[model samples]
Target: MAYTPELSNDQSRTLRRIAWALNMPMTKAMNAVFEYAGNIIDKKRVCAACKDNSKCNTCAFNQKRWSGSPHDHQKNKELCLLSLIKK
Candidate 1:
C-alpha cells in the first residue's frame, strides 16, 4: 500500500489504481504518471499574466484563492486547475 512519499492521499489512490491495473509496483506507476504529467505541464506557464502583479487584482486565480469563490473571469477554472496540478 506504500505509494510515493511525496504523494497526497488522492495521488496515492490514483497511483495505486494505475499500478494495480498495470500490474506494476506503486512507485513505478506513480513515476510513470509523474513523468508524463511533468512533460505535459512543464512547458505550460499556467498564468502568463501572473508575472504581472498588476493583473493579480483582477486575476481569477488570485480572486478565488483569496475569497474561496469563483471570480468573473473567463478562464478561472482552467487556470486554477493548471496551477493546482502538482499541488
Candidate 2:
C-alpha cells in the first residue's frame, strides 16, 4: 500500500508558490499553513474571558472541537477564516 498527497489545482499552485517563497518542501509549507490557520482559529474560538487555562476538559469551546463531524469542523473552520477576512 502507498499513500499520496492530493490537492486541488489552485491549492497545488498556491502551495508550490509558498514552498518556493520559503525555500522549503511542500510538506513543510503545508504544515506551516496548518499551524497558521490553527492559530487563527484558536485565537478566535477560544474563550477570552476565562481565567482558567488548564480546564480544557470541561470547557464548552474545547469540548465542541471533539464532538463535530469532520465536515462540520471543516465548514466551521472555513467560516471562521472567512469571517476574519470580512471584518
Candidate 3:
C-alpha cells in the first residue's frame, strides 16, 4: 500500500506544489521540508505590560515564529511584559 501523508488541505496543497516545483515526489518533498522541529514560548505574563492590554484579553492567541531558528523561542515583542522588565 502506498502511504499518503496526513496533512491539512492547505498543507497538502502547498506541499504538493512545492514537490512539483522541485520535480520530486510529494513524500520526498515532505521529508525534505519537515526535517526539523520548532518551539513555542509562553508569553502570557507579558500581556501585563502591553499597551494593547484590552485587545490581549480577548485575543485567541496562536504562536508565530519569533526567531528565524525554529528551535529557539523568545517573547512576543509587541505584547510581552518581559520587554518592559528587560528595559
Candidate 4:
C-alpha cells in the first residue's frame, strides 16, 4: 500500500494514546500492535512461497526478509502502520 503523509499527526497522536492507555513504552506498544495486525493481514493474503512451491527467498512478502525474520510479518504490519501514519 502507498504511504499517506497527510495523517502523520493523527497517527502519532493515536499511537501516543495507545501507549498511554496500555501503560507500555511507545515503541514496544507500537511493535506489538503492528505485529498483531500484520499477522491478521498475512492470514488473508496468500503466502508467496506457498503459491510457487519455491523457497521464501523468491517471494515478495517473504517473512524471513523482515526485522522479525521467520515471524516477520509484524515488520510488514509496521510498514503498513508507517504508511498510514504518513497519510
Residue-by-residue lDDT tens digits, candidate 1, 3-78 = 6357689977977887776567886665555544533442225454346566555433443334432322324322
Error of 2 at 30 (Å): 0.2
Query: Cα lDDT for residue 87, model 3?
Result: 46
RMSD, one per candidate, in order: 13.3, 12.5, 14.8, 9.7
Candidate 2 lDDT over 9-59, as tens digits, reads: 999999898777666787877765664454445533457756777866644
Model 2 Cα shift for residue 35 (angstroms): 0.6
Candidate 4, poorest ten consecutive residues by summed lDDT: 78-87
Q: Which stretches of candidate 4 lie over 4 Å from their true place?
A: 1-7, 42-46, 49-87
Report model 2's TM-score to 2 decimal places. Answer: 0.44
For candidate 4, lDDT tens digit of each residue in 1-87? 267445388887988887776667778767666554644457326563256545566444455555354354544433333333433
Candidates 1 and 2, the one with greater TM-score: 2
Each prediction's Cα lDDT score?
A: 0.49, 0.58, 0.47, 0.55
Highest TM-score among the candidates is held by which one?
Answer: 2
The top-ranked prediction according to lDDT is 2
Indicate the worst ten consecutive residues by lDDT in candidate 2: 76-85
Tell me how far candidate 1 lies from the true structure as C-alpha RMSD in angstroms.
Answer: 13.3
Order candidates by lDDT, high to low.
2, 4, 1, 3
Model 3, range 1-87, lDDT digits (tens) per residue? Answer: 277657899988988886776577887766545432112234454444456545543332313323254433323321221222234
TM-score of each: 0.39, 0.44, 0.35, 0.43
